[model samples]
Target chain A: MHDEAVAHEFQYASASHQADTAVAGMWLFLATEVVFFGALFLSWIFARHFNQAGFDAGAERSELEIGTINTVILITGSLVYSLGVVLIEKGKTRAFIMCAAAAWLLGLAFMILKFAIEWRHDLDRHMFPGADFGITGDLAGGAKLFWSFYFFGTFVHGVHLAVGLGLVAWVILRVWQGAFSAAYLAPVLVVGLYWTFVDIVWLILYPLIYLIGRAT
Target chain B: MMRLLRGAFSGSLGTLAALFARLSPGKKEGIGWRVSGLLLTWAVMLILVGIQYGVSRLHFAPGLRPVLLVLSVIMAALAAIVFMEIGKGPGINRLFAVASLLWLLILLGLGSMDPFTRVMYYVHPS
Candidate 1:
């Protein structure tokens, strides 16, 4: 009975130990995510290397300005989320909640910009891979391959961001309910790690999808 | 040139030492400092994106493309280490953190070899 009372399933020897285990778990998950996205990157590299001209053509058609804006927003959102983590660790519950809410808003803004505005523009321009794909000539096939990777990568990334945002909302709700304190902030820290990982993924994606082929 | 390099190296070392001192135990950063750091990261990201766009406009060498990508990755890594505090936990946690990144490098490095080297054959009938 004493052992059962003392050994709660969620209990650790110390708060620090719990935090460490959570961080390790999060990193291991992120590692898998890296390999998951790495496959798409490998496909992109080979496709671009073999068909530089076609890849360049497709890259030129991307919405560079909007993509850049979204990248900036995502990184800034991560920063805000990190700030919330810091505030929570410092025992500033109200401030942490506010910062978390701001971060969530920024994430929502990014999604709206990416899907509603930029993707709609892409569809209008026939950038989507289909019978009506917008490119032509000898480079058409290669360009289609580029668009395929582009849409696939960005769609996967968007889904991840949506999941991160949901997690952020969860953290914010918990903060409002006084579920976190200086002694126990592992949840906030782990969510921040996930948010920053998403941002890192976007950092890689930006140059590949938007910056390439702009020299033309 | 030797003297210049020495001076630059010492300068960087001094800056790093100062940063460590500021972040030493029992001297946690305040909210203001955290806010400033956040803004600084945002500004750095914006500037890097601008530079990338500008470089693309110029007829720069193709090799510069990979270099710019590396630069952005480094920037992102800095944000991860500093802001996300990936290195703040116990020693084993740090090992796990580093291992994850190493595994990613291995995955990408080994995974690309097949696609990069495979030969495709095309047949034409007369």
Candidate 2:
């Protein structure tokens, strides 16, 4: 276990106090992110409300199978990450590293499935929100807007996941160097929170993007 | 043929039962339990996806869409609270977590009111 010494420059009286403050800070940052993503969701809701048929058409054209698979992959990655945290908390470093590696691989798999497979498929279908967009007819404009939102939402989400994967890799390196211990797993826990937050965003996005308009 | 089918079904059930037993909370907390938990989470997510697909196929009343969306939010909240341990921390930490959620709700609620209520300004054919 690492020594219980608090890092210099922290105003907290104890290491645990410092950890608590750090987590609180992370939560505050996440709160801001919630509102950030919330604005996009609100816009989507309005767009769908006004352009129901168009949105439905756009959604029906989406690659539902891939989106569903990616959802499962991301959620499983989050679970693996939480398990890694559990192992770390138990002072089982080797098991923690294994779980972390598994989580990272899952994260990578999600990115590949989304960007390499799904986005390419979308591009082939001309789902991009521009002059080259493929949809035609009376609802073309509205469907174009819907596709715009879809591309923006998923692209931003992918970026966040990429950042999270980087964080996971950094944590793995730290674990390899024996920097983390049962007493100081704050970085791991905080990064896991971010990863899970990304998962939560996808959970919300899954239905909106893939499920809502399928039947029609 | 009937016996073979039944045997296969029972065999799958037995395997599932054994997996659940290994994941039981009272079982020794180790890699097995953790892996089981991960699988259980995956299963729940898959079930939710099934529900989403099934509901979409049902083509329920448009008003029901919000209800279905709420269900997904609840599932995500469960993962957040349980897997992320949002509430399993110091009181202040829990306060921050709860506050973040509360603020998000406020943002969504207030931000949505305008779009929900305001009339669209369509240009007349002048």
Candidate 3:
């Protein structure tokens, strides 16, 4: 590795200082994320409450196996991310890039699974949340509460997943461009933190969405 | 397998603690311990609360919500302790702490509103 002059101009006191700054920045960003996820969760709760039986109807159709698998995948992605930072510090560039790519691919697979398969099931079941949504329970009128929440909550969460993939792509791009090194592994750690936060949100969502049975 | 995971999380957090511990002791005499304490407590509390709802027949939903929210605030405080550069920086610490507390207020206040207590109220309507 060549000793780059311009890069050494603004000298950091130590690697720890740089790491600390990045970590602090990550936490601050996560604070905003907390607000974001918090609002979505609140909305889900309100809608679910408003349409208990309808939600239960939808829940019956949820594929627990898919939910369980996705949960495991995201958790595994988190491990890859945390471990990747350490590998980068060791200067294992190949492994580091592989980990980032794996995380990205896993994330993409999750989205596809949700959109292509899980979402299809909901659509076929007429759980579209808008006009076609219905009340299968004894109570009259479409179980509007359930369908509305299911649609809105998943859509909002889908947006978060999209944002997460965007961040992962940005990180992977830097890896491909050979920007990370022992002294500058901040990007991996920060993005990894963001990834884990996304996983945590799903951790809460999975049980809430799939576990609650119908009230009828 | 689960043991390894437990080890991984604990080990990393401990390593971070050890690193901070080694740094020259500053105004926050025991910030490392405090942060670790807060994190551990918050984690355990969250799990227990989750168990209460998921498995237990308690059905203690409303009363439990506020307590869990308070614990999450504490969790955020612990996170601030670490992120604020506890052993070295204070500016970021105060900022995060204040922000977390503000969040606690807004979420709990609006969240606890009787009319808005949709989740629990619907579960066991009054």
Candidate 4:
């Protein structure tokens, strides 16, 4: 959407042009999302710097195991989605739906792990920032800062995953209606790019939050 | 102690590395690069955290602080490059550039508010 007039201008032949436009626009939008998440990363970096010890302490207790499993699960989902894209080109709608379903199920698994397991565990452990955080360390307040970023980062990433799941369902619906074909695979590719980007963000978070403060 | 330390990082990076490594070979030429970039970032950040924690535990000279501090910038760059997929292509390059620039402005604008107040303090000396 760099130029309002440019976006409105449909100067191309066939639906492929529209598809490319959609792909380009989605990519540009993801670029904006990156900038948005970048702000959170900055705030966390600054705050964590000021309170490294506290942040390290907070990082120590985080459920890296659970988070790592979720990371792998999401990656598996991305691969399934990719396979679905490939199958769509060959006109395999049933397989396409299966791949989309796998991605959606994996996403649900991730949410369950993040919310039901990890978040609840943190709450029970009194690790929730600004809520019953009973941290008594050199960087006590900074510990809260760590949790603040941790929770917010994971929460926003989860929202992206939710939207990605929506896209997966949309793909399934379009497949059911025979809306996609070998000639029209842009939608699947576009959503894969988006879902993978979301997964990419979590990839960074997996290490930063859960693995920080480990050993050399 | 062994299990605690090993168990700590074994989950996130270990898992991501394994999964991402398989995706390195794909029909897309740049996908491997993207996955590698993401994996490398997580690996490096894990190292940096280890260094920081180890320093805090030991009686390392206070002077090592400067080196450790510089490491944070490196870690941040890794995260940015991986997430932004910088240098991926002409199309993505422009996107990453604008996105990072915009992020920098917003972050510094909000982050420096407190320090800027201190700068005004010395100038006005109220």
Candidate 5:
């Protein structure tokens, strides 16, 4: 629990002010991340615009079933984590911990499904953008570009997910130590912001990677 | 040993029950509102996913693909605004959010102009 007397940092006027600043600071970091991912999206736009047939061909090759499942898992994890944050705010510490654990497990499941099953399956089919690439003929170059985007985009997003899992783990430990209360839970809020942003990235990537051109 | 195992098992069940209670909407003011809102967000996102996947399975005009992409952007926006509580945040935070999107637009716009506009030309025998 927060000590009422020394509730905030020396730099802040009040505990609430400090919390607001922390949340704002997290937003600033996410703004930079927006640009970072935006560049990749731009590349994809150019590639898809010029090479529609090949790009669609590559998109059709993606594992739609697994992609849809992962999307469900990730978005569900975001909700579970959000619930944990709300529960903590209401001073339901034990329930909050349970929610956090559930969210973490969901995140772990996503990773396992993504890297172990999906990626392994992709490699088996030689989806990597190299000599052994599965697609061929006149559309091969564009298809290769699409595969490049798929591998790079998912890899970068997976790294972010790994980082999010670490943050969730840290939050779980801190909350378990009784470091947060209704009065002081900025860390939880910041971590929640980051985790949800990760989910948002995946949400956008889902269609680009798996949905677009599948009907072709 | 059996007693210890049983205790742990029951304890796990108790924790799950408590979590369910916290998540269930109730007469409680703040907790109920928050839980219901989050659950609603989850349901909406799930429904959107269903629609998106179903749409992808049927053939559509290439020009219509952007519509599906726009739906995805909406999902991302919904998560940002609701789950992140950006709507309830301070004014400056909203500014930052808007600025990030504006920057992304600038990047896409200017970056694409060259390739999209380039015309292969020949300065021939003149």
Candidate 6:
């Protein structure tokens, strides 16, 4: 184990204290993020409430199969990253690196499915909310609103995932450089928190975007 | 008599501690126990996802939408508690975690009050 004192910051009383502070800070940031995404969710509720039929029609038009597959990919990525956390806690650096690499690749797959494949399909279907939008009739207004939310929500979410991917890559580099050990795993733990937060956001988004109003 | 009472009390305390030590997932539980426990949580979450997807496909009442939301909340709680170790963290950390959700509830509840309660505005065909 690396000496806790070596990684210890001067401000904290002990290495453990510093680690605790780091985690608490991450939680604080995540709290703000909850409210940030909460605003988006609130807007979605209002839009759907006013335009129920239109929203349902728009939701039905969504690519459910691709959405489900991506959901699985993201969830599996989280699980892999979590296993890496456990491995690192045991000081199994090599095994942890392997898990992280696998998780990172899963994240990449999620992005490709979402952007390269799904977005292309959406564009071809005229799902983009604009002059070229395909949906018409009395429900056009609401369906347009629904697509607006879909594109905006997923795009914002994709940005967050992209950021997470970069963080994971950085973590892998740092871990390879021997910056982390069982005694000093705060960075890894906080990054895991961020990654999982992204996943949780997707969980909340899944029902709102793809599942809700599907039956109708 | 006082000495005998003290000894009995101490003995009971020791017994309670021993029970806790056995029951808790402490260092004695070993790494394998922790690893498997985490994997179990992951498995259950995936199963819940499958259930959510399947239920959405059926022709259920729209009111059942809340059930899906509830399931998602449960999954989020699991991830927060297990993957993030929110409960095992410091009390202040748990407070931070809960506070976000609380604030969101307040935001949603109050934010919707105006739109939900106010008379519907429609432009007259002038």
Give the winner by lDDT.
5
In order, the Cα lDDT scores of the candidates are 0.76, 0.78, 0.58, 0.66, 0.84, 0.82
> Model 2: how far is B61 from its true place, Å?
3.1
- Which residue runs of candidate 4 sit more than 4 Å off their true CA positions? A1-11, B1-126
Candidate 5 Cα lDDT to native: 0.84
lDDT of 1 at A12: 72
How do all the candidates rank in terms of lDDT, highest first?
5, 6, 2, 1, 4, 3
Selected candidate, larger lDDT, 1 vs 5: 5
Stretches > 4 Å off in candidate 2:
A1-10, B1-42, B119-126
Error of 1 at A102 (Å): 0.8
For model 5, residues B9-111, the per-residue Cα lDDT tens digits are: 3564465456557557676665767777777777788789878988888887876786788778888988987789898768999999999999999998999
Error of 5 at A58 (Å): 1.2
Q: What is model 2's DockQ versus the real complex?
A: 0.38
Angstrom error at residue A31, model 6: 0.2
In order of TM-score, best first, we have 5, 6, 2, 1, 4, 3
lDDT of 3: 0.58
Tens digit of per-residue lDDT, candidate 2, span A108-145: 98899889988899999998978888888888877887
Could you tell me which 10 consecutive residues in candidate 6 chain A have the lowest summed lDDT?
A: A1-10
Residue A56 accuracy (lDDT) in model 1: 80
Q: Write the per-residue lDDT of candidate 4 for residues A73-185, one digit (tens) a residue.
A: 66656656765664565566787788789888989989998988899999888888865686875767878888888888999998999999898888888877877656566
Cα distance off (Å), candidate 3, residue B80: 12
lDDT of 6: 0.82
Docking class of 2: acceptable
> Quick one: ranking by DockQ, best first?
5, 2, 1, 6, 4, 3
Off by over 4 Å in 3: A1-19, A137-142, A214-216, B1-98, B101-105, B116-126
**Colliding pairs, model 6:** none
> lDDT per residue, candidate 6, A32-140, as tens digits?
9999999999988888878888988898888877787677677767877887887788788887898789889988988998999999999999999999898999888
Local lDDT at A77 for model 1: 78
